[model samples]
Target: MPCIGVPCTKSLVRSNKHHLTVSFFQATQKLPSVLLAAYAELDCGGLDLLQGELPQSIANELAATAKAIAAPGKGILAADESTGTIQKRFDSIKLQNDEANRAAYRDLLFSTEGLGQFISGCILFEETLFQKNQDGVLMVDLLKKQGIIPGIKVDKGLETIPRTDDEKATMGLDGLAERCQKYYAAGARFAKWRAVLSIDPSQGKPSDRSIAEVAYGLARYAAICQQNRLVPIVEPEILTDGTHDIATCAQVTEKVLAAVFKQLSDQGVMLEGALLKPNMVTPGSECPTKAKPEEIAFYTIRSLARTVPPALPGITFLSGGQSEEEASANLNAMNKMGPHPWALTFSYGRALQASTLQAWSGNAENKAKAQAALLKRAKANSEAQLGTYAGGAGGGGAAVSLFEKHYVY
Candidate 1:
């Protein structure tokens, strides 16, 4: 028998031959076009329409977890600083700062009970990530077991700008994507990148170049993090400089944040999966008259709300040398007074850990008291996040002044 569309009769003699040939051609030619069209539609309308048409239960669960992490009254704990920074802090307390001490201190914070009630996640320094507790469990494992997501700070500290006498840029862009992938595999679900911006009234408002550079850096970092399936904490810190008043700080912060969001949008970052860690607006150290906590809270939130998008996961304020009580009080007031669009919480380093370190003084006997002090601050800040913090209750310990001229990178 002669074959149709085939050279051999044997080839054409297969069962359902005609249907098979048609199906093959359709898959080879027409099916690609059909798939392309579906993809185009998905690209235009996003996963919502696709999910509506084709059910994906996993996607829903992932989204719910993200929402819970960024929900109101919750914030991230930022413990991801370099050994050098931690050493500086340890030095202040007259303790022999070493890798062991660093690990111990972080283990203390991660092992605290009921942390998940307020802290949605923790950003861990590289050393602390793989370190084990006294019981030999990995710190990352400890955090996961307690329902807190572990994060890593990926920036490799700031580098001095070549010609700008006082300016610097954050490094760690080299191999960031791969680093993020490894961090994710190591139990980190998120990452943080901080770009420093200084207030230079001597040159008037921050230079357009400076603003654009930081914005672009943050956006690029966010994209890389998202590509690796890690949520990025985008932080463009407006350094507290000069005797500039709170109004000046607000203006500069607004400008910086606006630029950051514009770049974030430009880079196609998924805002729903990211967080913003920002400097709380406050007068500079040189500013003689300090604003009350209420004023600071009002201006800080008002400025942030003006610039940050509502789709952002959350906004965790950096203490920026504010006293522990001041930081908590300001956060408390913001929560109390707000019609805030996003959660206002803390990612403080010095403000949160300074007191605890002092109380500990690197002694084994002081462990319980140190842990209690740490928990006290954590509890106070947790309460502050809920807007019910009454001042002078938990954070009554003597304050540790970590402020020095140009303290940050």
Candidate 2:
């Protein structure tokens, strides 16, 4: 007898082979109309197999990927800021700022063994995305081989607002969605867009224009990311340029985050697949009295919890010019203060890179020393993620001397 299953030979052949098929018309016609009606009345909407489109297994894979990236006691390493920013950092350490040096520096970080122990993802700038290591391995491929998700920073640098001479706005909306598609094709599983805001008390509270602009910008960028299947790190930073106290900073941060989340919701963003990179609440550079690391952590967390929705995958605090030890200490304290609604961790740049550059000093022989320094800071911050940081107690008091008055840009 010929096979009657859906995969039978008759089904696989063209029209001429149909004579070999056995007809089921008699059986089909024997079914009662009432039985067919009852079958039609069954609500398959609740059935796993007939539910809206996405299969359960694929959905579960997406959820697992997001969880791994935003897992507690682990945070992303943002090596993604632009070459100019990295160059400025290298300049501070009196090192040569060239393409090869930059690649070497990044390679030093990526080459670290056991980095996956704490770092869940590494965000790369565009230049780093296409660069290869000395051994001829693509950086993105190398990262994925170690089980780390490779991400890309999508926004072009901030530009000066045309009419508002004092204010700056982030550009790159031009062709951004297409760019996101390209990045996704190039092995980026996530993308970042940073929007800058300044706190100008003299000019009054955050202007409606600035708030609306940033919120809309982030929401659009996030929507594009979702369409391309990339998780977005939405960062709307209220820069620490004023002399405001921690309380004022907290209030502004709350307002900014509230607006951001509202816009994200309005844009139908999937919060579960997104991460937030926000500035920790702290006194400004010109503020005479600086808060301790503990104070900073408490205020930052409290403010975030009040504004950021619980649905977000995670909240990664930006170091925002905090010293390495200070950033680590603050992160440790935040984790220590009881429970938080979301994973509290670091997306630091300068804080993580400063010591490494200082140790490297542009010398080939010092590569080991530089790598050791990078690993030490990475491990320290990793421990901080778990509230166990203990590296620089009583070494230097928390201070804001890093910023000079009318600091040269």
Candidate 3:
């Protein structure tokens, strides 16, 4: 039997008969025309011989999770900073980065009253995902109680790709499938993997090798997460470490996104089951002229429109060293620009927590104050998601730059 547009060779058909196990009817029902054609060519006996589950169910669950996380008026809280990263944050407040202090701080954030109204999900460091609150309740349970979905950061940081101009690729793929399973069983319904790209024209930075590595790594990570029933937030973050202007950033961002989506498609990732966590187009951190939120929003949305598909559920903008107010304002500007195909929301760590952390400062007496600060930022970003934020919610830290050259995690 010959399949339309599919070269169903006798050897291929024989291999399918020997290895395929999904119910042919069910698998073919909603399959793409290409796959359906191939399946249609199968003998009745071959169809009956096929057994086991297909990715359709997993895809359904992933899509549902992605949609819920990208729901309107809600965004993600990126609390997934690694231990070393959080230590730096704690050092700024003159607080210890011990396990106890970390637990207490996260407890304060997760227990904030009505946090779910704004934050639909939170990306957790592995420790935080399994840590118990001081009250002895599981931390993930606290997030769930507040109606927030729990997600895990699965990447193990970055390593320089050989033969490249110091451009890096995210690691942690060795046991990703097993790790994702563990995370899913631990109550995480989503995962985050960040791929960093940098712009440096002098050396032809972000070489083709670097881009290919990043794209393939992200696509593979997304595939693994979806296989394990986790919606993957594909983050290809273009580092804001250059002296490039906003237009340059936009161009780089569009180029990177185009490569990313191509790899995702080539790897068979369902766009609806994935979310994009990308940097908003902006001037490099060292650039002289700081673009306003409106300008940032313009380039960001235009770049995304040109590269990102509507099938994606959302585009969660990373702070990428933007200030708290800057992040919120940029997000608001994008949404206000009206009708974009995907959700324009935030997945910010410092932008969402800088003020809150300052307010907390590891003081038990300041728990309520800190929680209020968390809620305030969450609310600001939430309103921004709907283009309703009026700004000024970032408090005194609003304009403070959170940039760290070559930031990790």
- Estimate the TM-score of every prediction: 0.83, 0.81, 0.87
Model 1: per-residue Cα lDDT over 201-319, one tens digit each: 88654777778878988999987887777778888887776789999999999999999999988887766567788998898878898888777876776686568766564678888
Question: On a 0 to 1 TM-score scale, where does candidate 2 land against the true structure?
Answer: 0.81
Evaluated at residue 329, the lDDT of candidate 3 is 88
> Roughly what TM-score does model 1 have, to 2 decimal places?
0.83
Q: Which sections of candidate 1 miss by over 4 Å?
A: 1-66, 395-401
Quality of model 3 by C-alpha lDDT: 0.83
> Sorted by lDDT, highest first, which candidate order results?
3, 1, 2
Per-residue lDDT of candidate 3, residues 1-409 (tens digit): 5432235555434222213211222223233333324544665422112212224456557767888998899999999888899999999999988999999988998999999999999999999999999889999999999899999999999999998878899999999999999999999999999999999888897788898999999999987787778989999999999899999998888889999999988777877678999998999889898898878876776687678876677888899988898889889987876555577888999998999999888899999998888889999999999999998985677779888998887
TM-score, candidate number 3: 0.87
The candidate with the higher TM-score, 1 or 3, is 3
lDDT (tens digit, per residue) of candidate 2 on 252-300: 8988888988998888776656788898999987789989877887678
lDDT of 2: 0.72
Highest TM-score among the candidates is held by which one? Answer: 3
- Alpha carbon lDDT of each predicted model: 0.73, 0.72, 0.83
